[model samples]
Target: MKKETFLAFVALFLLTLTSVVYALEETTKTVTIAEQKADITGDRELDTILLKGVPYQDETDYLKQIFLEVSASNGTAYTIPLESGAKASFQLVDMNDDGVKDLFSSVQTGGSGGIVLSYLHSLKDNVLVDLPVPDPVEIDSHFLNGYQAEIKIKQTGKTYRFLLKDRKSYYKKLGLYYKGKLNEPTELMVNSYHSLKPITLKDGKLGLKGVQRVAGIANADTIAYVESTWAYLNGKWKLDNVKVLEKDQ
Candidate 1:
């Protein structure tokens, strides 16, 4: 072979190698807790990424800029623009039971206590599409009503309900006291927390069990209470079977 041809071949090979190295650097990234990153696709690969920008100089500026960079395993890159003042994070789950994972994002909305801003996003045709997320009232209470697959927020004296509807979350109804009364809350009314514990049901399908802890009603000294299995259906949180778990002075 000619020496000139050999030189040309070597140059092309070097250029191709350089492009591959640059692509790898762009695809590999690190996420910090402050960013609230998650793998929204459920692909077991962290393709979704979020980066927050500095706040505006004026406090009145309601929009806080955010950059969402998605890097596919096949060397595809996409940048999405999002605006919110709160620090953002995400949870990836199959919210609609559609097998494909859905994205749930939350941002801290500061107030007397702390409020959270929620948003939902889903992947379609390899792009992130914004979906409606459940929004509860301004969370001024300490006890978060967060249960699995639901966004529950208890306000000062009232708890607002929200649930997924048609692949989007919306305000459903208000929570009632165990006695079937409009749950009128007070600063000293009650403070409760719930959890969505994973369990294997008799039907052999994986499910989440809702367990609520009624810590107090009026004050720390008030101990009379009840424990129940809660389920949200028909736009209401119904007590499956109420049992007088504890009662006292």
Candidate 2:
């Protein structure tokens, strides 16, 4: 993968983990912990990789693990290692409907850069083959914490926490908590870090999508955005029309 492509994924990932929330006074909304479902990957399918190891490594190691498949049916279960400092926890999933599981897992390096790479391995001719996620740009030497697929729900007037959308088009996990009865926020702020890019689902695979940054303001005519700065709306930023912006540059 080219370096810039990797860099975009890193940004999307950081946005998900950036921890975006402001003071309640300025931000009029509250998101109670609605539902927390723990899954290794964003896919709702069960995380079977945890069972591979007899004694699961320390909890932290789980964060930096990768997976390679070795099945008797697939001639010895070995392929190429795409990333470095390999520690892994992964389950098999058929991302391309090929009827066989291609190896897929989240991985990280222990070295100074410490970049995480998620990959796929397809069983072709009874062998495991590696395939990186398809992207328009090449990813190169970018720092990342992790990657995820997510869906964010916005109630008409309530605050809600964003969940991993079973259907993914965004690069990173997007979360939201909807609380209509609580205070309404003045604006909707999307804090972007690495890996936090626009995403959508296509052909049952997670694909890059687009995003818009909107400020919380409103006039009878139209919602306004100052370059890449603000957004205006009817119910303000927290609750209003879902449109009126463009993707980040």
Candidate 3:
């Protein structure tokens, strides 16, 4: 479908409880609609724009399109333009309180190796901006061993805080490394977001636990996916489970 047509369909689909409108206008600056990306910046608004590119002729503004989540329902999907320098991508989530849905986007800064910056700009009208990485947790995806190291997060208020995670190297020792003298986990980080802890639940309570966890997307053909697990411990994330963590008891 044409960009304008798709934009209209999406806006109508998203207008669950609130009425929405779609507008695509041209800016004076030269824009790159070819490589646009969108993201949800923690807010619930739906915004889109083309990623900016290098310098160009004056007044050759990049094409700017404004999209609002016309309806707010779950599983609501939409296509947003990729900015000039942005890698085409989308982020879908339930941001509208009306049980509706919306989509955000992201752009790959470089090749597959470098970090691909993404955001959930629900905090405002799907506005595009640099994502802020938290400083507390450490992360690495070299060989994502969710079997022993899982990560999870929860929102405290305005900020999203790390929750719980599991030990890093227990896949070799046993199911968990609660009693073993393990080295401080080598932190794994991308965009500076650390998958330090993996949260687990064994009993009626939910806290930190060191256990191997693994889950892959179920698809006939294969597609990219995001999965991290962590366990909570001692007001922070330790590489082990809080349940059997020897020193704790």
Candidate 4:
């Protein structure tokens, strides 16, 4: 074969191989992780709800693409996409007071911060809609002198102070503190929703409770926790209250 012809053939072969590999990476295999029977369409008929996702390369517990498949009794099938994470699960609850079950899902991020992603969806009247989850509470935290830290909840204008005398040795070793004083201005790390779940309120209505973590220098470092209560009213979510608790020693 001529040298030019042989080089062209080699290039073609390499191109074909690259295309095949790219296709495999783009392809995803989905599997059902959980299934349940519930009436979410407000039709008083059973609906088959299947939680499906694509595992991250044979990691059965970690999903890359999570979705929901609902087969309504009225001969309608719906697909809803959700965030990806590990240990994906859902609960059927009447969260919006529509008298129909809503799909509330939670996924563990499996990160050092122990963060979680939550979602809510309603399929009432054969229409699928996403219900917005409550946003994390905004906070302003900073290291203070005298081995102390302060966190202020911006929403409620509440401030909390923590004494870190017990952790003085650890903070000193990490150069975060020197002689009971902060070496420099540093802010505490606040993580997103660690857990969000439906709860029954005082007025016999369903609402959501979200818990957030505030860490010191490191994610595992102890600091405080913020809890927020929310109520769904007038077609929107309303913040009921906020609570701050110091981390147990």
What TM-score do all the candidates reach, one by one? 0.37, 0.30, 0.26, 0.88
lDDT of 3 at 144: 31
- Residues 109-201, candidate 1, lDDT per residue (tens digit)? 443223344455566445666754322222232222231121123322433322213212211233423223223432323333222332334
The numbered model that scores best in TM-score is 4
> How well does candidate 1 score on lDDT at residue 69?
61
Q: What is the TM-score (0 to 1) of candidate 1?
A: 0.37
> In candidate 4, where is summed lDDT lowest over 10 consecutive residues?
56-65
Count steric clashes of candidate 3: 81
| Candidate 4: stretches off by over 4 Å | 1-28
lDDT preference between candidates 1 and 2, better one: 1
Which residue pairs overlap in candidate 4's backbone? none
**Residues 119-231 of candidate 4: C-alpha lDDT, one tens digit per residue:** 89999998998988889999999999998899999989989999988998898999998888788999999999989999988888889999999999889996998999999
- Write one digit per residue (lDDT tens) for candidate 3, span 36-153: 2233443444334333343234423322332223222223444333444223344344323223323344444443333343343343343433322223323222223333223333
Model 4 lDDT on a 0 to 1 scale:
0.90
- TM-score result, candidate 2: 0.30
* Residue 170 lDDT, candidate 2, scale 0-100: 29
- Candidate 4, 52: how far from true, in Å? 1.0
What TM-score would candidate 4 get against the native?
0.88
- For model 4 the local lDDT of residue 28 reads 64
lDDT of each: 0.43, 0.32, 0.32, 0.90
RMSD of each: 17.1, 23.3, 18.9, 3.5
Q: How many backbone clashes does candidate 4 have?
A: 0
Cα lDDT, model 4, residue 39? 85
